[model samples]
Target: MPIFTVAIPFYNDQNYLSKAITSCLHQEFQESFEILLINDGSSDASLKIAKNFRNCFPEKIRLINLKENKGVGFVRQRAVEAAKGDYIVWADADDVQCPQRLKTIRRFFKENPDVDICLHDCYFIDKEGRPIDKQLKWPKSFEENPLYFEIKRNYFFIGFSAQRAGLNIPFRSRCRDFPEDYDFILRALFKNKKLKLIPEKLSHYRIHGKNRSNRHSYTYRATKEILEGLNLSELSKMLQNSSCLKEKEISLAICELLMTKENFKEALEKLKNGNHNCFYSNFMQGVCYFFLGNNKDSALYFDRAYSLDSTEPSVQNNLGVLKYKMGEVESAVELLKNALQNKPDYLDAQRNLKVASNGRNSLSITKKPLRLSWVY
Candidate 1:
């Protein structure tokens, strides 16, 4: 088998699929690898573009065209099933991989036979392909656990946003959901698999209108679907024992997951003992109170949170909404303005501020922008 299987999950992406394929064809490793293209019912010219790769490199490319538009998740699942390389990697259609990507990952796997999955630091570029966004500087590497059992972030074996995580063949299952991407990586880690890291920035994560990160609601729904399928009790216990996370953070993570489902009551309960100062906890508590029409308590927690931290656009976001509802439009505008000033990339702040300001020239708030919580 080739040392790597580079899989691309694509839909109506004729404009970029060719660039992705050409990048794959020019890997720096100059070693054996295969490109498995999963075409998820593209109504555009994507199919023809992908097929052309076969004509150019018959031994290196294969295409799978589905009958209908199922979704990106399903497309990836199919590609994973078709992949034959000892190492399986996913590349989103619009993103371009550096020529050395395969060589870097391949070297890691070769040096560490125990490593099952590998990923490199990544950079984010704009829609115009400008390197004006995210820069990959992996601060930690995974070595604490047997690597196979550690579901980690920061440290090497950082949780693959699936930006790049490759598993050895004989894989257990395909990722059929959004949240499943996170859980799937965890499972792959523990299936007697280890993960290695390539610190160099070898991938460019293209951020554009159709990027899944932009569709928070759709991604969250997929996450809900996948999370609901897992054995929470079993998974929770498994997480507790793994090297992937420490106790407090994992519990907070579980609570965060529950909050996404809008199980606010359960979320609040789970967070009662959570040590971390989670803005989500305060936000969920506010949500629970808001739904109950306990505006006073809701306001109280939101105020406390706003006072505690304001860096996270989410907190400032909630605080702004609360202020607006409380007949403090001016205050809401100020809060959101503060949020925007802190992080220009925050959509919630920009959206809420524009709506609240109604074309106002300025928002006046004296408080310094607060530090944001790390999680939503």
Candidate 2:
């Protein structure tokens, strides 16, 4: 049996599936590894491409073609079930892997036997395979508890990481969106947190018009579904063991979900139940009150959020806009200027500052720009 099984699942993406499979087939690792390509009922030429690679390397490559259009999670689960290796790696059809990726992961696992999962870095590429974003590095805290960071940002791409086999084959979660990857990793880490990281950029994550993660509303609903599925007891335990300020973060997540649903009262109630000192919780509360048309209470919560984290440019811009709405032009201009100092390219702050300086009616503070949290 191969030492690693690289699981590649493809849907209708015939254009990039060949590139993904070729990368796996050309791995320079001295040790053996198998490529398992699962075709999820693609209406396009995806299956034909998989079979073409399988024909060339019959021993090293295998194919599993599903009859119906099952989702990505289900396809991945099928791939894992059919894998014969001791370790499993992930590969999206649209992403490319570095040639030494398998070799590097093999060496790391051999050197660090205690770690059950390994994650490496990857850079974002455009549709034409040109680098568009810098290499994404996992924060130090994420290195400590990868699951927590996964909740915040799903940076651990299937193309850059591998996990030991014989754990949960089909990772279960309520999330069915593109970030179902996050839910899968969370389940993998729940029982074993012994995750290690390699400091190399080992994959290229392709970003295109079809990237599902760009759909903010859909992604947020999926994430909230997964978080809500976690019982409070388990979630609280996770917070206690993993982080000091995690409760506040958890509360903020819940509040954001409520706010998205326009449950302003419930969002405020949830935020009040945890660390009120958190900049996120306070800011979310301000948002909820602002939406509910309680401008007085909204101003109070915005001030609280500013006091907690005055350095956050988004908060400063938000409060500045609110102050402008309240007829405090001088204070609004000063706050907007401070925000610009913190982040010079903040277009909203610059625009608001310009309006305040010109003594023109400010844009309806109610029409706030998209939340900064969603952009990342």
Candidate 3:
């Protein structure tokens, strides 16, 4: 049997399937590895492309054909179930692996036999296979405290980890709404699995219009699912060893998610148990009050959030909108201008600035509350 199995789940990805497969074929590791391509009922010529490659290297490639279109999560779960190597690595059909990818992963597992997972950064590429001058590095704090960092944001690449065979926890379905890979990693974190980060870009992540990470609806849904599964008692126990995470932070995070779900009173109640002096807690409290139609209380919390973290564009813009509602037009305009200065691409601030400038209060400030990820 091969030392590693690179599983690529395909679905209407004909345009880039060849490049992804070719990258795997060109690996310099010279180790025994098999490429398992699962065609998840793609209507396009993706299966044709996979067949062509399989014909050229019958001994090294395997193909699984599914007649019905299963979502990415289902396809990935099936792929993991069918993987036939000591270790399995996920390879998205649209992404390319580095020539040394397999070699690197195999070497890591060999050197660190106890490590169940390994993560690495990726090179972001455009649709035409050109590098896009961006690096996807995990936060420095992630290695020391995976639970805390994973909750904050997902930075792991699909091919970043090669797990040990027979690790039966299939990728969770609720993750289909979020980036499935992130949720998969989170599940592993919840199990307290040993994770190691290899500080090298071993894969090329192609960014395009079809990328699931770009969909707001999926993000909302996935987050909703994650929040529903979160328990204060369980999380407190998990973070006992984390350097940065604490009970207060976790409570406020849940509070923010509750506010997003429009459970304002419940969110406020949760906030009461957290550190009100914290920037994020204050910001979320402001959001809850704003949605509850208490402009005075909203402004108070917004000001506190701003005082704690003056550089946050979301905080600046939100406070500016509240100031506008309170008839502080000049202050609102100034704050909105500062927000734009901080983040020119912030649509909420830009729209609010224009409305404030035109002396119109028609724009709904609570229309799309910014996610915690947007706070900076």
In order, candidate lDDTs are 0.63, 0.76, 0.79
Off by over 4 Å in 3: 174-178, 243-276, 350-376
Highest-TM-score candidate: 3
In model 1, the Cα lDDT at residue 82 comes to: 73
Which regions in candidate 1 have their CA more than 4 angstroms from the true location? 126-130, 137-183, 186-196, 242-247, 273-284, 310-312, 323-337, 340-376
Candidate 2 local distance difference test against the native: 0.76
* lDDT score, candidate 3, position 179: 63
Off by over 4 Å in 2: 172-178, 243-278, 288-293, 306-376
Question: What's the TM-score of each model vs. the native?
Answer: 0.73, 0.77, 0.87
What TM-score does structure 2 among the candidates reach? 0.77
Please rank every candidate by lDDT, starting with the best. 3, 2, 1
In model 3, pairs of residues that clash are none
Q: Model 2, range 1-376, lDDT digits (tens) per residue? A: 8999999988899889888898887888988899998988899989988899999999999999998877777877787789999999988899999899899888899999888888887778898899884546456576766666665556656666788887763654343354667677766666665777888878888988887767765776676666555544564566567654556666665555456556788878877776577667777878888888887888898899789888788778888878888898788888889988988977778887888888887543422223344113
Candidate 3 lDDT (Cα, 0 to 1): 0.79
